[model samples]
Target: MPDDKTALVISAHSADFVWRGGGAIALHRAMGYAVTVVCLSYGERGESAKLWKQDGMTLEKVKTARRTEAENAAAELGVTDIRFFDVGDYPLDLGPDTRDRMVDVIREVQPRWMMTHSKWDPYNTDHMNTMRFTLDCRMVAQAWGHNPGQKVLGAPQLYLFEPHQTEQMGWTPDVFLDITEVWDRKWAAIQCMQGQEHLWSYYRNVAENRANHLRRNSGGQAGGRAAKYAEGFQTVFPRTVDALE
Candidate 1:
């Protein structure tokens, strides 16, 4: 645990973090938080259709390409500690070993907050499964009995980032973050995902739309905070506050 602020992102796939939480990651980094991203898989088997279309492509090659793209994106987002679990994809292998590894990371980071996928995603079970797995890891990390003499994790707010087809996923944003200052950084990171080029514009549109929502919620035309770009999140737990403003 460092002396400064810290946060963690548990991404189901290598590029998931970039698409979903890049702006938040960049904005927090600017605010002096050491953001650690953990990619459970490269999404090579399921999400590498474009790479597979290319001739002479192999599993390792796809994984390598995806990893490189993730690294590039993470760098653009100012994330220096991006980790890849290499557990495999299509259906992530979230076994005992993976759980233990994730628990260890949770304990090590002791993040003030965490981010992951939505609770439900029928389109991609991997995404939903990852969210559940992350929750389990968080719980284990907080248990003193899990690892004797190891530092236990503190309670951290878990924010569920926006998912594709938000309505279908049953995801409603309770928090809208104005990431106008870091939109350019997020855009640069989004460009690094060459494998999923089709989604570049889609996510950009998401940011813009979310920004509109932010503006409306802030105060509408009556002295609303102007935000050009933003990100939305659904909190899994209730927030404790001294007073409701």
Candidate 2:
């Protein structure tokens, strides 16, 4: 096993991590993993509909509000580090500069595992694009020629979190994490995303449903673990294990 107990989460929007991977973040933190979150954009333009409805709302003000909410949510999840790229949303600027920055962060963190959005999300191309961008950065970070003096990153498992419309996204989860113990922390983090109140209940329902999946997959009624809340993930790479237990 790797000596460093660290994990990274790359989120397209500020509040995306809270809704999608908050439970994992909290649970990992509780297990002594330092979880770092990177928010590529504030989601000010596209996702802050509730804030936009209020009077005197400018782009900067909206971004600030979203940032605050993200920070508060990260605190609730016990995140070790939270970074904001501040790159524009709607169509994220996943240019060479941003790619280099991400690669640098990947090298610096040297995470044991990583998490991001699903591979496909037609409704929100930003979500899909972020996953691609993450893959690109991960590859570059592992290239020895990219940055000679810097330490090359080792292969880390990239887990794709459940999307909003799973049916449309073509995402199939192979891993179900039981977050029952950290449900309260995840719920508190979810509440911090005040700008997107509409999604609060929807994600709660998703967690409950995933918990049922966890129980069924573990063994159904005979000897299944009763999980009250859970999160699902589809891994991009095959996991190497020594034993099949």
Clash counts for the predictions, in order: 0, 0
Model 2 misplaced stretches (Cα beyond 4 Å):
1-3
Which pairs of residues collide in candidate 1? none
Q: Write the per-residue lDDT of candidate 1 for residues 61-176, one digit (tens) a residue.
A: 99999999999999999999999999999899999999999999988898999999999999999999999999999999999899889899888999999999999999999999
Which TM-score value belongs to model 1?
0.99
Alpha-carbon local distance difference test for all models: 0.96, 0.95
